[model samples]
Target: MASNKPALEGPVATVAPADNLPYGHGLGESGEAERSWGEWNPTEETVRPVRGRHRVAKQRGLARSSTVLGVGVIAAVGAGGIATAQDKPAVSISLPDVIADNLPDATSLPGMGSSSTAERDTASEVLAQAPLTSAGLTAADSEQGTTAGEALRARILQQAEQQQAEADATQKAATETAAAVEAASQAKKQQTAAEKEAAEAKAKAKAEAEAKAEAERLAKLAASYALPTSSYTITSTFGQAGSLWSSGQHTGLDFAAPTGTPVKAVHSGTVKSAGWSGSYGYRTVLELDDGTEIWYAHQSSMTVTAGQKVSTGDVIGRVGATGNVTGPHLHLEVHTAGGAGVDPMAWLNGKGINP
Candidate 1:
């Protein structure tokens, strides 16, 4: 410390004062700096704020324009990799180009951690790879820098993975359940429809069978009343021409009578079977008690429905030569309840009215 120290003046600054002071070098103010450091009468250019604050310059440190540009380029490249590579399509694009387009978003790269893990991870990796001027960055990048990035990237990736897995599981489950339910419902509907159709068919067949059986029964009964008009003459008795008959025996009794002779019923019964019977021409049958049957063949005409009931001696048909008979006549037969044939004459006699 000097003994005769002069009091400092002018703008106060923490910097040390210069030792060399020339006489008559200061401005009108005593002790003013010889060199004009600043002037209040500033030009338009000076009126504007300085290019930057010293504090801000200090913060930037040695981060030059070249360094910033390189960092931006690196960040852009990394970001482009993530953006361009997202859900790769049939075609591919350059990762570097995409990165360049996505540059100038440094803050977001680190902040993206709060968002999707995948995005955060990608942004963090890009951010870390960028030539940074942060306190964490090293001046000597020659020592290969670590792939240091924010934790947001990993978190984003993890979240993405978890969400994708959940979505896949949900989709799979829905597909399986839908298929199963559809199959089950289809089977149930098919079964129900099949059952209904089958039931209806069976019912129809049963009804038809019943109708046929009833017709046959009534026709047999009608035949009973159509016995030979007058036992005038038995032109041919059943079994007379054994080999000539289909059953190796005659199935009916033939009686000779004038053509157009009134045929009458032999017993009280209902008309059952009646129709053209080929060689027998027009024929009819009557059903009686205990399901017994009587047949009439070779008739000139039929005058009754299948289920008409008649008393003995009732006219049922007229004798004719419509069958394989040489003369006009009537043919008759009797059948047991089991369908086995019997002597019609005997069956009539048993009914108390001799044929």
Candidate 2:
């Protein structure tokens, strides 16, 4: 038969079976089994190998965690890069030559996935390197940005008020100018009316004064004239055609009166003749300062002597039918400047006397 026991590799030791044994419980209990079973015993060598395997598994786990963290950091950097691209200014800005020296570079900042210690140091360096004025400007810019909108609103309102005030001033100036012009026009109109009224009043006073002077002249002329006789009737007018006169037409006015009616001189004059000549019997002739002779013919008697100065209203003769008369009457004739006889009635009317 083939050997049932297998060979041992290294140093081997054997232990005897116990004497008290249960039936069919020894290594030879089942002859058909090809291997023998042994009880486990802890040893330093085996425990040390198990401990090393556990350390290896821990190492693998730490490597996997580190890879995951790196992936997350790369994703964050990619996202930031995309955001920066999207937020880029439409036009690229170039720093001014003066300020370009003060600007910081991008590479000097902490990169993504950098060590925490490096990030903290970089942050501290950046803060320390910043100018004090720049830091203050950052804070001031934030505050000023917040108030800039309010300032703009206040300026807009102020401009609106200023414009409104200007408009009001312009309107007031226009109104005042118009009012002044209207007032001047009104004053001018009033002045014109007053001047016209004054002119009319002056003209009226002149006309009244002329009328009064004319009346006074007429009154003075009336005082110097007189009628030849009173209470007498006119029998014949000058230029009357009658067969009783020597001429074909009557050359004088005849006043029919009673036999002894008085006849007066018509004006202040000298008696040129008082005796009868022939046809003019019992006659009187009065000569005035203007050489106008007034003849009183057909008189019963003559009262004024020849060449005697007679005043107006002096009785020159008595009315009678003494020469070629049909009845008792006075024949009156007027001669101007030694000319032919004129109408005695017309001569009396020229002196403002209605005979």
Candidate 3:
């Protein structure tokens, strides 16, 4: 008999002894017992039921547990060892239908034998080394698929660019506004200067016109007057200081000429006197329309009598050496309507005459 040693794997079964059986007759007494091996077949009535079904099930459970424990041990060994066995071909293990159906796959466990340990470790390292942020990526890394960190980085850059553009636009607008204000200010200043210049030109033109009109009026007045005598030289002017006058100063204009030189009326007037006075020889006094008086003294003759109407330039007297006279000269005097004597030279100049 074989030694009673344990089997490496499988379920063990137990059988019970049968009590009824056809015993083989001694040597020549074989009737129903003379059966060949080929003619014998098992029937339901020939075989008896075994009583160890529950025991077999229990043993199967134990065998399945042992298989699971063996697989765990193999996985542990593989994890600690080198992966030299990874190149070996896969092995197909066969199991009983009952065991196979109840067994869980090794890969389904927490840490099992799906791949080599070296391969798994290398994959973990690769995952750890991958960049987590786009900011740290190089140009080559940018070609890779976008991650969450890369997306966030792109959005931030875009927002910053937009804000910078807005700021530049605002600055440009402000510069344009300032330039426009400066232009307007310059225009206003130019307008003010132009207006002031125009006003000055207008005032100058008005002053010129007024001066021209005054000159024209004076020219018309000078036509109505004439000089008192002809062929004479002015010897003494009015307001002269000398001892020959009745007053302390000479108050008349003197015109020296040859004797019998004609003395004419200076303007249209009536002769008020045509006689010799105390110190005036052959004196003639003319009264104008405005009641002003003109005296012509030191005359050689009197051509007009008193109350005679004399026109301008009409002969009224002659030049002679008369009383209170130094030579043959005419002394002429003018008095205002209020009886005040004035300088004859100045009075003639006021009427547009030089002498």
* Whole-model lDDT values for every prediction: 0.62, 0.67, 0.70
Candidate 1 lDDT by residue in tens digits, 1-355: 1122121122311111223223543444655433332222223442333443422122221123334434533544444522432333323322334335645554444443345577768889997767554344344533555322433344578799999999999999999999999999999999999999999999999999997886676566555543447756865665666666777777767777887888877777889978788888788888875698877788899877699997877788888878666677888888888999887776654443354
Please tell me which model should have the higher TM-score, number 1 or number 2: 2
> How many clashes in each structure?
32, 0, 0
lDDT tens digits, residues 265-327, model 2?
888999888887798778888899999998889899988798899888888888888878888
Candidate 1 wrongly placed segments (more than 4 Å): 1-228
* Prediction RMSDs, each to the true structure: 22.6, 25.1, 17.1
Candidate 3 Cα outliers beyond 4 Å, as residue runs: 1-200
Greater-lDDT candidate between 2 and 3: 3
What's the distance in Å from true for residue 199, model 1? 70
Q: Which stretches in model 2 have alpha-carbon errors above 4 Å?
A: 1-204, 234-252, 277-281, 324-326, 338-343
Worst 10 residues of 2 by lDDT: 1-10
Cα deviation at 164, candidate 2, in Å, is: 10
- Give the clashing pairs for model 2: none
Output the better candidate (2/3) by TM-score. Answer: 3
